[model samples]
Target: MYWSLITGMALAGAVTALPRLDSRQGNGQVKYAGVNIAGFDFGCATNGNCNITAAYPPLQSLGGPDGAGQMQHFARDDGMNMLGGTLDQTNTGKYDQLVQACLATGAYCVIDIHNYARWDNQIIGQGGPSNEQFVSLWTQLASKYASQQKIVFGIMNEPHDVPDINKWADTVQAVVTAIRGVAKSQMILIPGNDWTSAQQFPTKSGPALLKVKNPDGSTDGLIFDVHKYLDSDNSGTHTECVTDNISSAFSPLADWLRANKRQAINSETGGGNTASCQKYLCQQIQFLNQNSDVYLGYIGWSAGAFDPRTYELSEVPSRNGNSWTDSSLVKACLARKAS
Candidate 1:
């Protein structure tokens, strides 16, 4: 389900995980850190069209609503090198603009298809779009950015409620093969069922997805994707955070990733700019940094397209003239330097 509330304003973003090999030196430092600049995916849903009009398109020419400017700020000021939100597949023109802006920042951009394993509320490969159709989407995308090393293919966004996890793996495998056909070495993030929940990853979706292989029969750049929220219900809608999710999620999953010599990314995570959030969110990031060997990096929930004065979980840094002030949660947690 589409969780974040969208209004008639600009919010564009994407979260990308960098290659782990660069920062996997047994040090407590995350390689990739950034926030989502959400906008293009605003009008989209499982059973609807992404109303391009409702979203503020952060094109290059638009100065204040400049999506590119947001990315540049994250990279220059916050030391972030990965930025993005979700992509509207039908709106390729806007997507092209978003990618160009991301490229200008010298950061990686995750091209996420925010369909949640379904098209029109029907699960892909199960009853909705056939596996071939899904493959076609990736094939086209991979071909488009075949040479851009900074581009990461997020196979799908937060797949959940599927009847068979194994079947989903098969579908992912097909897309992997198709992507490899064009973009040979780019990273492909494979997510599990149950909203790609970090707590349930190792047990539910990890095993089946681990078997997915590349065209050459090796899992070279295929990274696992997971999401976690700090609220009581893990819905991410509330401002209060009740847990750090260490034991309930990250710890066990860390063990699994290490055991298999695989790495995963917390593609989405964040909390409100409040005391409770500041405490738990910082702790959660520290854990990921400490275990950076298995945990590649993290991308906060959002920033782009959101008005800091309005959005509840707004991670967007406040700007006054030429100055940019990061939210407390971002400065203390999401954008915290790797130590």
Candidate 2:
């Protein structure tokens, strides 16, 4: 199912190349597009009951075309019991399916760890695997996927309530450096702390993250991964969207990226099926279109084979017998203007 669309020259000059599951071959660079796959990393599986049924994904999405080439997910969280300080491999099959689905669509997939600032509710600085262990976890994961160039590593998901933001940034840099050692070219997504909220990004965690330098102190080859839901408080759980939250919250991040000559992708966003909610969703997409120079694209809150539509943000395509159809929200996302 790997596909490509030959579009005009380049949509804003050099859209990042979307690699394949096995080979990087394609017509040329395709603008990145994506959706998030939740549950595996933070749901019952992470809690220790190990809900294998929900762990696997396809978590299917609406048909038409896979507009977003990226699928971000919690590759690892505290769900599976880690051996010593390493990530648990007991539940790798579920994630393998997710990676495979992204590859099938010829889209780059972002595998994010679902743990917030803490693991098991304990702060990183207080008590957790040392920084070296954090690096080790990624090192092992990257080594396994080294041959899969299309897979992007989202080191951690929504780190929040940290004691030291600067130290956290340094940890993020260290994680990136470690992954580079094993996986040479895979893109790394650096998320800001304070829940990685777009509205709170610039002032809270974006600065320290910007200061994160490569081995040479010159940063490149990374993108900021931020999330913004349409709810009143931007909580993914809610269905209500306050009048201007999306505009005000995300605009600042777009401005900062534009000013800094950097780029980012909204890794998560969603709302219930209401005119207002859909309006905000469409507006946010348009907002990104206006800032294509500094914005890559966005990923809807989620959709998955196992993700029941009962979830407020579930965008998993409708299961039509053996086939699948698009949900209204996914429909709007696919129709977003391509700048």
Candidate 3:
């Protein structure tokens, strides 16, 4: 669900306050629908360093010609309700415009920390950055967006290869405490290790991560963040898809979620624009919509700063004059609601 070269992400900080908002409180067929708006998180890598020099220019810089219009098209035109953006620790303030744009479009904003459980290639807490430092990063951010009801804190993106999964959970526990200390009602999405792989979640990381609780000792606004792709090896790089991942991934994960009385979100899942992707991706999302009881919703891999024609799994809409045309995959699947 991510490029190896430009990985890792988090969101900018804002002090503005608004009313509390929680969109996934009731039983339904997935409460939120959205796409990821990349670019602000362009220069990050699994090593935990974000080179601002390698990042893409701000979408706002493109002005109405297409920058802000991209988000508007997805929200107003595509009926998407949530918008995900990357936030890197080195450039937390870089995403303010992206966040503001998402808010203006009347969509929920998921500020994701795109780091893969490490900083400078050292595993977080286990040996790399101290847990306090991680908590501190969240604390400052939580305080800044405490009043922004539409803000959703994506604790970390795709954690993997941690030596002690239990310790990682403890680190997440601390981050949750720090965030809840400042923002009480905003939703927080927590990702498990192994790239938050849905296939490995129920067994590998779920047990420990499930132990993580809100300060109230409840799992109210906290949701599990999972990712699944349809490529042969599930790396998300190939242009063709080999499976829908229902039996191999989502189905088993769904069963576990229901059995545990918890819910999860498919934070990232997509395939290239092809007939194979069309058939399988549609089925995958349909499964999510059907099992909305334990699933919040799904967000496609991306659609920001990436060109529609050039990007492999492009969900970015193309513009012709004043009209916009969504990618074939989006039109046929991601943007389509349950029947």
The Cα error of candidate 3 at residue 128, in Å, is 0.7
lDDT of each: 0.77, 0.55, 0.77
**Model 1 score (lDDT):** 0.77
Candidates, ranked, TM-score: 1, 3, 2
Off by over 4 Å in 3: 4-28, 62-65, 86-93, 337-339
Better of 2 and 3 by TM-score: 3
Model 1 Cα shift for residue 170 (angstroms):
0.6
> Tens digit of lDDT per residue, candidate 2, span 1-339?
000010000001122352222211223212454445444443332212323343333333432222222222111110100000014565565456545654554445667665564555565544654688778777888898888776677777676677788888878888888887887766677888767778888788888888876566545667887877777666667666554355577677767776666677666666765667777777776667565656666666655432444666655555444444556665665333321
Estimate TM-scores for all models: 0.90, 0.77, 0.89
Worst 10 residues of 3 by lDDT: 10-19
Clashes of each: 17, 8, 9
Pull out the clashing pairs in model 3. Answer: 8-114, 9-113, 9-114, 9-115, 10-87, 10-113, 11-87, 18-147, 47-121
Which ranges in model 1 have alpha carbons more than 4 Å from their true place? 1-25, 46-53, 60-64, 86-90, 337-339
Residue lDDT tens for model 1, 1-339: 235322111111232333444424348877778887777666665443345456656554543366777777778777776775522556565567788788888888877877678866788999988999889878888899999888888888788898899999999999998999988887788999998999999999999999999888888878899999999888787788889999999999998887777888888888889999999988998899898878878888877776778787888776678767788888888764421
C-alpha positional error of residue 336 in candidate 3 after TM-score superposition, expressed in Å: 3.3
